[model samples]
Target: MASPRRRAAASPALAAFGRQFRRYRERAGLSQTRVAQRTGKTASFVSQIESGKKRCRREFVEIMDPELRAGGVLLGLYDDLNGDGQMGFPTWFDWPEIEIEADLLVTWQHTVVPGLLQIDGYARTFLSTDEAVLARLARQEILNRDVPAPTSLIALLSEHVLHHFVGSQKIMREQLEHVLAMSEVPHVTVQVVVNEDGMPAGNGGSFVLASMKDRSEVAYLETAVRGLTTDDPQDLAEIAHTLDKLRRNALPVGMSRSLIRKVMEEKWT
Candidate 1:
């Protein structure tokens, strides 16, 4: 039979978490079964978790923290890996961490510029609070990291998003200029999706998918009220399909850059 899959396949934080958990268990003179019983989980689940073949939530780590005498180390590791959700997203959301661990990130923006590529000026237009903008700027630091290799981004922004005015004219121009500058980065590709062929836009919603080293993907779906973050296989499949459709109708890299430049000069000016 094939071996079970590993959840912490390439996440450094996750790997470290599993390693530290094992040390704590061993130090406490407990077997996996004993630990599992204490934590109200099956022995197999504990085994899988310590072996890096399974994932756990912050709550699980919280349980393990006191039980294993880890104090707060386990909780800290969990926070480091899955993110603390300080980005105005759901508590269960793994966004910036997902972005950091992902080998490939695909974004479809129907209205605004993709967050990762947005300049401070354009981003402030959407964010009402200074704290929120600071959170966004902090996440952007991942784009600068080289240790785990930069995340390759394929941004498919709708053409209308470019034409629409956000904030002042100067801010809009600056944002597109930032977009163009970032597109020149080797790992980033910006594509403008022009619906000349009239393909349905999945109700003009925006979503992002991060493809990790283990080939598992996470999706964040944008809604009016609040964005939804999901890892459900079916939800990922549908979102992936929609992302593919948007990509198919997108302009080539060079042409997309050209179009962005044209719009910035003509409309923003």
Candidate 2:
């Protein structure tokens, strides 16, 4: 017997595009085989593209543009995916592509819950805008992908994150429960930095350190208005050092969960 075909993991952006492509193809009343025939590829190939296992080729996009009547929508996505610089995602401010491809993700959040770890209600509370909410929800897909190697995430959250009420007490309670549940996932580790620890390292702001498949590293820093992603050796080293120090000061996993539960019960309740 042959082994089952491995499903491909997709970046948040690619996943969104795949969803759009599938929707447009279905709305056009075309089957995968028919689309494949039009594009001169196998049905399996078309399926892979639509499922985000394989990238949509430019030629295929050219054919699909007219077949699906997308009116350049498909081409625009193609350009963005290929990094041709013609189309950019205005709402997705963070480096989702790198985040999805990372083998290890270390995050430090001083205020709110990190986007990937947030529950819908928690996210919706602070996101406010529909576009921002959708973009954040889309980024969560990386945590749920089961194939192409699951990314390991270590999140060091300030204890204040547990006490900070975004929407309501109920929302905060549910958010804490969500985090406790997520920490149970094999690839995810959640730790808390207690307020008593004085000023933690990297108290400057929130940031993410992504260790990519190729052994390269990148750091993402967020500001009031925008985010910055850098692979500069010095920046990566500095951010990595800060993350290491923060992790050292954070509570152990079991204690963190206990703290979260305590906060949920005592404060949020």
* Candidate 2 clash pair list: none
TM-score of each: 0.72, 0.65
Model 1 Cα lDDT, one tens digit per residue, 1-269? 22322443433334445667888989988898887787789999887787557777667787778888888877866775567542122343346767777788888888889889888888898899989888888877667787877788988888888988889999999999999999999988899988787665655488888777887666778888877766665776677667667767888999999999999999898
Worst 10 residues of 1 by lDDT: 1-10
Give lDDT tens digits, candidate 2, residues 37-107: 99889999888777556777688888888999999987876776567542233343247877887889989
**Model 1, runs deviating above 4 Å:** 1-52, 55-90
TM-score of 2: 0.65
Q: Give residue 114's error in model 1 in angstroms.
A: 1.2
Top candidate on TM-score is: 1
At residue 8, give the lDDT of candidate 1.
Answer: 34
lDDT at 75 for candidate 1? 80
Runs with alpha carbons beyond 4 Å of true place in candidate 2: 1-94
